[model samples]
Target: MNDMKELRILADACFSAQVGQALKRFNASHPEIQAVVSIAGAKDCLQQLKTGDVYDLAILADSGVAAAMMPDHTDGYYVFAGNSMVLAYAPGKILNAKNWREKLSDPKVSISHLEPNAHSVGYAALMACMLADSVAPGMSCTLLNHPGRKVVAADAEVTDYAFAYRTECIAKKISYASLPDTMDLSNPAFNAHYSTAKHDLTGDGKNIVQASAISHAVTIPLAAKEPEAARDFIEIFLEHNFTAQGFQPRSEIVGKSPRRIHAALEVRKPPRVQSANYEDEADVHLLQRARLLHRQQPAAEAG
Candidate 1:
């Protein structure tokens, strides 16, 4: 009875590869805990927590998710990992990225993100708001009004954690390109602009509690067979081995990294989110624009 048992893990696909490696390492080191992992989006993970059903661990894209859940739940939570938002662009857009940036000063950029209600999307929404009003104000309307942002309303899971580059650019699919994870901070690029790679706004957040400027997100959740065990998982995430294994450590990657994809880019965090009101972040405008696209099939007749 002393040994931990029946561990359920819910996490975003972003950690799919990393978590598997972590668990393999965990099992070799500690065999007492039995863990089962489910690949869920950030919003799904949140739903798992709120329903009060049954789950041992739930890893998510943004700490804001846990913060929003227990507005008072701050004490027990922790930031296990850190990531930046990637301002992905369609292939065509990247072709003339600099021009696009200039055009994006308005809504012409045609930005896309996970549903706003999802944990990751919640954060992306915050970024969208900032992008729209930051430099010249209403600049992001280029992306926002592209007709693609409308389909999939909230794609938090896709934004913050999807392991692949294309998922974030799900809307303008068939073909796309992105900047590597080590995005440039000084002069940000548009292709796949991640948050950690974005530059800071200067003298705005450094005084508060370190800069969370990067657009990408990190996952945090009050998860575990016992919340304490979940807390221990966070501790492990922050441990040296997690970083040594090439997994981005919270310290080196978190507020510490000077990741700024584009000079004009700014990072965003979520306020509070609930998956119940989740929307789709599908590429509504990707029909002929490209090959892949989102679709809502008709409910089959009661045949």
Candidate 2:
């Protein structure tokens, strides 16, 4: 008897919407292969691999992190998209300010992000701060860290601003302001500027992870149970246009000669998607939605 085929994809929260959309398209084209997606912080996703957790594929925001896994945890990978960091602020917080810098430098304004050690965006925020500190001396803003989904929630209590992916702001329709290209970690042209900002994720005096232009990549682990299925998922993911999500194409970022280490996706007619249930639809919505507010739980009060 033929065993059931399944593809499990793990991705950074920033790519949640794109991965979700790709999975849905994969399902429609190849209903026989079961595909699923899980979202986590970039570091946490890579940590799972380091701990021997085998996933069919992992799409990470940081290309450097994925490169470190090469030939050991994963055999191959490719950059599919690029993104930039933006300052997402609460309504009426920065509306009257001259620019994002002025708002961020204001003593009364507060800033927040996910924990730097666990989340890629958090580390990006730290790097942004370091870069900002260089430009505006003695800038003191109240900085906070939320260990969970608190900072990205719809009702997030960010009094002034929070660091977030540009895609998140676009997907959720949140008001945001762009930082200088160097501070945003977006343009490859500012690679030299980006190099100046760095952080030691492990809190050790070593293994410093430097800031680089944010590029998203997908890789199949060496221990992946369904490598072929993983390739099929990647094919589907590449076929989709994510411009609406504020993502730049891989070709745009890396140049015209894109790398395809594996053989090109075989062209074939796609099978019609079968009818889906409410649960299936719900899963699609959950992944496609950028906000994590729905997953948040209210804090318990003291008895």
In terms of TM-score, which candidate is strongest? Answer: 2
Candidate 1, 184-284: lDDT as tens digits: 11112322322322222122442111113222223333333444444445444433343222222232233321122212222233222212212222232
Looking at model 1, residue 195 earns an lDDT score of 39
Model 2 CA lDDT for position 20: 83
The local distance difference test score of each candidate is 0.38, 0.65
In model 1, the runs with Cα more than 4 Å from the true position are 1-4, 71-74, 90-97, 102-111, 119-126, 148-232, 239-303
Candidate 2 local lDDT, 31-50, one digit each (tens): 67889888887667867877
Worst 10 residues of 2 by lDDT: 271-280
| Candidate 2 Cα outliers beyond 4 Å, as residue runs | 95-98, 137-156, 205-207, 252-303
TM-score of each: 0.50, 0.74
Clashes of 2: 0
lDDT of predicted model 2: 0.65
